[model samples]
Target: MRTGMTLLIKFILTFVSAFIAFDLLLNNDISWILLLSLVAMLINYLIGDLMVLPAKGNMIASIGDGLLAAITAYIFDLLIPAFTTSWSTLLWFAILIGIAEYFFHLYLKKDEKVAP
Candidate 1:
């Protein structure tokens, strides 16, 4: 239940961020944004939240999540011809995700079951 809730929140955050940064601003396709959000959420949840958050701590974990988001976006941009974005835009998107993840990490830390 806890993990489900966490993923839900993460998805919401990722979707909104990607929607604003990619779809709304850059005129990217909604379908691609949706796919990006899901992939980014799962990867960040597994690597950043589960592994890094528990081992390294919130600051590091959030940074990792941000980097993961940027990298994921960059890779998608490369693979999908319709997904267009610049480096500065990617950096801005990363910053947004990082800020959200910081607060999210705080919430996760409150729950003992989340970390260990």
Candidate 2:
């Protein structure tokens, strides 16, 4: 249940960030933005939240998440011709996601302390 909630939160954050950067700014299609957001969220959750957060602590995990977001977006931009975006846009997107990830990691840590 907790993990589900975490994923939901991550998805919401990722979707909003992607929507702003890809759809609103770059005029990309909503479907592409949605797909990109989903892919980033899942990979970030798996690697950033599950693996790195537990091992390396919040700062490292958040940085990793940001890098992961940028790399994912870059790959999508490369593979999908319609998904046009600049490096600056991708950088901003990664920063937004990274800030959100920092707060998210804090929440998870808090929950860990409260849980048995």
Candidate 3:
């Protein structure tokens, strides 16, 4: 169950990070719009990961999830034009989401290395 728990934590971290970053960077009100966007980003990562489930759970999964997360974040941003989401905003979320996930995964790796 460690894998599952780690995955869930990663998901939550990515969601929260994206939400907070978008809110702070864009200076937008934290409303349903931001919440839904975060959800979309999460969904994108989940679906992309599932699609590559046969990759023996390697870096491919992470790469796919990262790409999808960025796309979904952008799509959701566009889902509401009032947010004034530009390519830079999308790039920010994309890069940060991947970085957040990468660091979280590394934390898990470091623990595994220390474990008996």
**Candidate achieving the largest TM-score:** 1
- The runs of at least 3 residues in candidate 2 whose Cα sits more than 4 Å from the true structure, single-residue gaps closed, are 113-116
Model 3 spans > 4 angstroms off: 1-8, 53-58, 105-116
lDDT of each: 0.89, 0.88, 0.59
What's model 1's overall lDDT?
0.89
Residue lDDT tens for model 3, 63-84: 6556666676666666767554
Q: In model 1, where do residues sit more than 4 Å from their true spots?
A: 113-116
Q: List the candidates' TM-scores in order.
A: 0.93, 0.92, 0.62
**Model 3 residue 64 CA deviation in Å:** 2.5
lDDT tens digits, residue span 1-116, model 1? 77788888999999998988897779898999999999999999989988998899999999999999989999999999989888877987798899999999998888777534
Q: For residue 90, what is the lDDT in candidate 3?
A: 69
Order the candidate numbers by TM-score, best to worst. 1, 2, 3
Candidate 3 weakest lDDT stretch, 10 residues: 49-58
